[model samples]
Target: MVFKCQEDSFLKEFTSKVVTCTEGQLKTVIGGKITTLSCYEVVLEDTIFFPEGGGQPCDHGLMDNVAVLHVTRRGTEAVHFVESALPVGKLVKQKIDWERRLDHMQQHSGQHLITALADIYFSYPTTSWWLGEGESYVEFDIRSVKPLNLDKLEDLVNEKIRAATPVFVTVYEEGDTELRKVRTRGLPDDHKGAVRIVTIEGVESNMCCGTHVTNLSQLQTIKLLRMEKGKKNKMNLYFLVGGRVLQQLSACLHREHQLTALLKNGPADHVELVDKLQKSLKCANKNLQAVLREIAVREAACIKQQVPIPRYYSLHRKEADSDFMSILINEVGDESVLLFLTVGDDKGGHMVLYGEPATVAQLGPQVCALLNGKGAAKGPKFQAKISNLANRVKAEELIKQYVTCTTSGC
Candidate 1:
């Protein structure tokens, strides 16, 4: 049956008697745990709370101080889901969440205006619409939206919004519905009796049951975000309505200020400034790597020139990479030396091993075990990420203890 919300979208509070109350389960998640909550489905004699239907979310509010958790339609009735049960036939005050209701009304009404304008100007029929968190979208049956059409459409839509046109709903009999030839967003097959039509002044009429504002001005503003290719070659148009436009503007302004300060330039020059900085960083990194390669070569040469080659050589340093380790090993050019090296800080580190094929094959798993880590080895090279810095010394000692002349030339 039709309710007060469909009759008067602006109704906030109303007194209604409870017609029925039945126990039910409301599944909800709290603290990442799924819980089944015992709830009461309370049906009122009449309600101002809109049910979840027609692509619009259900209304949330309170019934006699008890929180109304959910509102859903059961067959032909609007059921209010609450935590505690109220006596059947008892009169109670029902209050709708005005902010939520008004926000939904603005967006739903804005969608009607935009949809109607698109159809009248571009002949693009809206196939579906979605009311999102910060923005909403309408899908058109057309393949693409040309720039000129979009520009003209947006201009005309905003002009209507600025005109503050009146919006009102009318209930039409079955015969009158056909006489008016009113376009609908697909009427349900099971729907019967009179059809409710929402008409915008000099714009369009649509059959809709969702709540809507009384005037176009209530939308405040409507900005078409963009159009993208949708499923099956459909064109999806995104838009923001009312307060969301203001919220998006404020967020964009904040980010612009942040980027301007970070790039040390005006908003207009931010893109150029970022491009220059990225190029500079790339060049600086190339120069730094060249210097590091030279240092790695020198260090390897010193280790090679030692009077007697050590059986085991372990080094610990911060921020060294696989390239440096590979370069150092190539400089030594020895199958004899067993090298166990750790690079990075106390938080975490990468460990590498370079030695004869036999030596690395035997010691790779043992070394990883000592470091409380896991890794794989191939031939004379092995690498692993060390999980414990305190185990670094113990890992090095294990390599020394396990070293043998049979595995390596040492």
Candidate 2:
């Protein structure tokens, strides 16, 4: 059935009797959390609420002052999901969210203009389109789009909008001869009503079931943002229409102001200042690596020169990485003296143990378990990623006790 919304896209308020109301539950996500709400599926005699279809989201508003959470088309009926049940056969006032409806109308109407122009000027047919929450895009049959062509097309679209061209709908019953002239992607299998042809006067005529503005001027303007590669050899042209264009401009200006303050420079100099900051950071990182390597050499040298040699040595660095551990192990050079080296802070890090192969195989699993780590042994070396560095002290004590017990023949 053609809904009241489809009949007149500009209708904001209407009165309709509730035909059916059934208790139901709806699972939806709010604020990034999944929630289930007990609701009622209310079918109105006629509705101003548009059901979700043709890539446009459903309308949300109030039915007799009760929140209508969602609306969906089931065959020919528009089912309204509401928080509370409405009395069947009672006439109730239905209100539309005018801001949301206007936005959808602008974007939807703008899409028709772009689609028609692309086909007329460039022979590019629209394969699909998306009306996203933040932005929208139309997928064309071509594999790629040129920037120059996009600029030309965008100019043409806004020219038509500025001209204030008329846009209207035409309805055709089954087997109507005029229906043959309208461009369509074919009707849904369950479609059971008159075919609605949306026409942009002197531009194009296409079959559509979504709400649209009565004139091209309502779109305000259209901006082709960019093109992205899509699956199956297609190109998606992302865009903004109407108020979205103003919103994007405002957000960009806000970000530019923030950048100007942070960089202590005007907008034109932001790029140069950022480049210099990146180079400075790179140089400082290089210097830090050199100092870390020197510290590793000193640490290994101190262990090597110890009197009578130690049975085992353990060292942990909170601000180091596996590269530091490798440098320390290479400088020490004696696998006979067991080495227990760890890098990173109390949260997590890397660990390496080097010693006699038999002792390493025996104690590696025990130490890994104690530290909530995982590792594999290769010859006399055991390497692991320690997840619970808070247990580092316990792992060190275990290694020391095992070595002392072995030496004392306990």
Candidate 3:
């Protein structure tokens, strides 16, 4: 199989018949079983999934639909951290989603253009590069800006992109980066590996971890999304590149179409039409409230007529929810032997006992037990609703019972 035996480094590529995998330095096909597949880092004999080094993300791909999410290297050994189980020592082919990989390249390359433009046209030095959300941005050292020469800068940068200058990436050791007069930052002091740099012809020379396009044209187009002001000496230049610009344009067009349909107006008239519609909506709401008030006033008389006595218990509204019964009980109630009934879905309406405090207290317990209602009375006055059929007959009986209890008491 022309395989070279190694201790802790990548061995040879062979049509592995079977693999006896284990927690080894690198993924190797030995016996026939796989082991230690869940750890974040491993050593693999052959893998194209690039480890997360510098600031660039770790490359992700699948082997037989088994996802390898993160890769890490120890010494010269590369480990394949996979999500699923795999047959040990089996020869597996690799497949990568190129669209994702190329996207990272475009975003990373576009970042260099923006960072360079800042220095060349605005004298703003970039402080950081956060490659996130499949996009990247250059954070300038100085956040404050009076105004920018946007037109001139735009023309100048476009000219450079059109020039399609050759871009080169390489690794440098130690002080070689500083000696070369290329800019670098965010590197740890203890990092001993090669410091990667991207050099554009007659343009930017900077350190970065993100994968970048080989040529300037691959960056396609970079449209500045916004420049956000931050703490002292910090400004974030947010941007979109390549296909992301088209996505933004498409979304904006869709929103415009939706607004036009909703307002029943042309694009140009949308704002004015929306305002008119809002005013109409407010007037309709006002009209609705007037109607409801009229309805409530009409029902009040009918509710009072239904009451047999000049009792405190009167339904305030015909179409009242439980809240209507509750508000009526609280406002009109006095300490007297009383029963409140509102025919609707409610915990029977309020009841009260009319008498001295001592008499009401004596009868309160009997009323609560009989009507499935609750409350203590000052006189015979308690307020509750007779909502349940089991307690309906007892509603009148409880009043009579309380009458007997109050009159017979000391």
Candidate 4:
């Protein structure tokens, strides 16, 4: 089914009749968890919202004031998913998110212009494209891209945009005479009806289904940010277009100002100034770590000389890591002494157990269970991360109980 959005991309709001309504599920994965949501599928006779397709995302807006969560296309039908069902045959007012629609249009048009120019200049064809929030990229079927040619392409695309060349969309019947010279990615096997051809003045004429601006000038500007190697030796070119270019430029300038003030240097000198400071910091850290190791050795020696051996020796160091704990444990080596050492801070802690094999073997699993932690053991040393620090006291008690049972055979 042909949508009204296909006719005029600028249509912001419209009244459409609800042709069909059905219940369905919307499944999404967030942070590696699959979530299923109950929704009602509302199919309209016509809509201004663009469904997700052609590497461009779906348009979001209101359907009779109910939030339209997602819009998907099944075969020829564009399905609108909402929380509540709309009454069939009822004429409802549909509103499209204008800002989002315009952004998509600008980016998509910019993509077509760039892709065409790239193919014409370097004979590099676009393999895929992705429209992201504020940024977008197109992958070309080339091993590597030269920077100078990309710069030239950027200039060429902007030149076209500045010219404000008219963009025209023409529909052609199957096996029509005018379809001879038009370039296309080919239609789907079951595709029916007339094909739509989008042309950018004399620059390009390609078959596209996505929405586009009426004029190249509406794109505002196109900036080629960078190029990187992608899968199958393809080159992926990243870019920002229209208002997003201005937004990125503003953010960059703000960051440069902050860096200049903090570094006490000009914006141009930031890279060199930061490099020098980073090297100096590295040298300082190396010297500081040496001193810390010496202090740790002395502390361990003092602890070892305890006249009456403590049943359980526990140490809580705020900044200690696993390696530092290992160094301290090695220096204060006494297999018989059960150590309950907690590293890191109150946000969470890491526990390390050092004792005789018999006691540590049983104590490691018990302490982990008591603290609701996870870790493994090697010989008499056991290390684990404690997610719940409130259980630290209880974990220490369990260690004490194990030690008493092992040493005194209780």
TM-score for each of the candidates: 0.78, 0.86, 0.59, 0.90
Task: Quote model 3's TM-score.
Answer: 0.59
CA lDDT of each candidate?
A: 0.85, 0.92, 0.58, 0.86
* lDDT tens per residue, model 1, 1-410: 67888999999999999999999988767788988889999999899999887788889999999999889876568989897999999999999899889888888998898899999988998999899867889999999889888888888888988999999988877667453667765656655666688889788778888999888988998889999988998999998888888889999999999998888889999888889999999999898788878978987888888889776788776757778778888888887888887777767778888888888988888888877776889888888887776888877777876875444656
Better of 1 and 2 by lDDT: 2
Total clashing pairs for each candidate: 0, 0, 41, 0
Candidate 3 error regions (>4 Å): 1-41, 45-47, 53-55, 72-79, 85-92, 134-136, 146-155, 177-180, 231-233, 278-410
Cα lDDT of model 1 overall? 0.85
Model 3: lDDT equals 0.58
lDDT of 2 at 135: 94
Candidate 4 weakest lDDT stretch, 10 residues:
185-194
lDDT winner: 2
Indicate whether candidate 3 or candidate 4 has the larger TM-score.
4
Model 2 over residues 1-410: C-alpha lDDT tens digits? 78999999999999999999999988888999999999999999999999998878899999889999999988989999999989999999999999999999888888889999999999899988999889999999998787899999999999999999999998888678898888778888888878889999999998989999999998999999999998799999899999999999999999999999999999999999999999999999899899999999999899889997888999888888899988988998888889998888767898999889999999998898888898999988899998898888899999999999999989
Q: What is the total number of backbone clashes in candidate 3?
A: 41
Q: How accurate is candidate 2 locally (lDDT)?
A: 0.92
Model 4 alpha-carbon drift over 4 Å, by segment? 29-33, 257-269, 303-311, 369-372, 388-394
Q: Candidate 3 lDDT, tens digit per residue, 1-410? A: 00111111121222222233344233433476553333333344555555555555656666666666656554444456666556666677655556666666666677788778878878988777676764466678884754455555556666777888777776667567363677766565545556667788789787754466677876667777667775676987777777777777898899999988877778999888878888998999777656655554454444445556342332323234444433444443434424343343443444444444665566556655675665655434555443453554565565565566655772
Best by TM-score: 4
Write one digit per residue (lDDT tens) for candidate 4, span 1-410. Answer: 55788789999999999999999999866677998889999999888888887888999999889988889877677899888989999999999999999999999999999999999988989988999986899999999888899989999999999999899899888788778887776776656777788899988898877888999999999999999989998999999889889989999999999999899989989999999999999999788677767767877887878888666787777766676677878998888778878777667778888888777777788887777789988899888987776778888777777667866989
